[model samples]
Target: MRPGIHPASRPVVFRDRAAGTLFLIPSTATASKTIEWEDGNTYPLIDVEISSASHPFSTGTARVVDAAGRIERFERRYGRRPAPSRG
Candidate 1:
């Protein structure tokens, strides 16, 4: 820990674009910008454009990818034949 050069730690609100929601938590950040909340208090609201809420995995939006087929194709073009399965 240093003396006076450390980043300021404060409470912040992170807004999720996908859910259109605000999450309040402690964070080192800047000051509030505008008064828009019900309490008339505004903190430096950090807006995150993307998160797991809208991402492919956590939101049941993942797509099936045939990566193994591509690997087989590459092997057909350049790689040697792998040893046959014994089990």
Candidate 2:
């Protein structure tokens, strides 16, 4: 182990602003608030909603796509620009 090359394991916090969720983990608690975890340790409490902790990819929650947007229709009307192509 070098003098200052080894990675340190510190407490961190992850928060979702939208969903208003907060979690404390061992890494970098740079979100918001504070919390004392069960490992007899304390970290900053971050408010987050869709972190890997509660996201669909990790927790199997379904993703809701906004279909109300008429993407195709909007694009068909005015969503293109003349490409400046190279000769």
Candidate 3:
């Protein structure tokens, strides 16, 4: 709750370059560039490479690893050894 010690938080526009999306949110981060929002107001613009729009998890485009296939390949490459007899 300190007044002067905290960085000023203001409305800033974050532009996802890859997704071509813009989001207006309050942040302490500053930027040299500015952008005109839909409301006809100019705000500090921050360019980002990845966002929810383009992320694999968010878009459901993530690749599913096949553990069974990998195990089969490994067993084929190196033959499976016999289990030791329990004394």
Tens-place lDDT per residue, model 1, 51-70, is 66677787897988899998
Give all candidate RMSDs, comma-separated.
6.4, 6.6, 2.9
Ranking according to lDDT, highest score first:
3, 1, 2
**Per-residue alpha-carbon lDDT of candidate 3 for residues 1-87, written as tens digits (9 for 90 to 100):** 978999999999999899999999999998999999999999999999999988899999999999999989999999887889999
lDDT, each prediction:
0.76, 0.66, 0.95
Model 2 worst lDDT run, 10 consecutive residues: 23-32
Write the candidate numbers in order of decreasing TM-score.
Answer: 3, 1, 2
- Give model 2's clash tally: 13
**Candidate 3 regions off by >4 Å?**
77-87
Comparing 1 and 2 on TM-score, the stronger one: 1
What's the lDDT for candidate 3? 0.95
Please say which candidate is ahead in lDDT: 1 or 2: 1
Question: Can you give the TM-score per candidate against the true fold?
Answer: 0.56, 0.38, 0.82
Instruction: Give the alpha carbon lDDT tens digit for every residue of 1-87 in model 2.
Output: 667775676767676765566556577335455667678667767565577656676776677676656666677789867789999
Give the C-alpha lDDT of model 2.
0.66
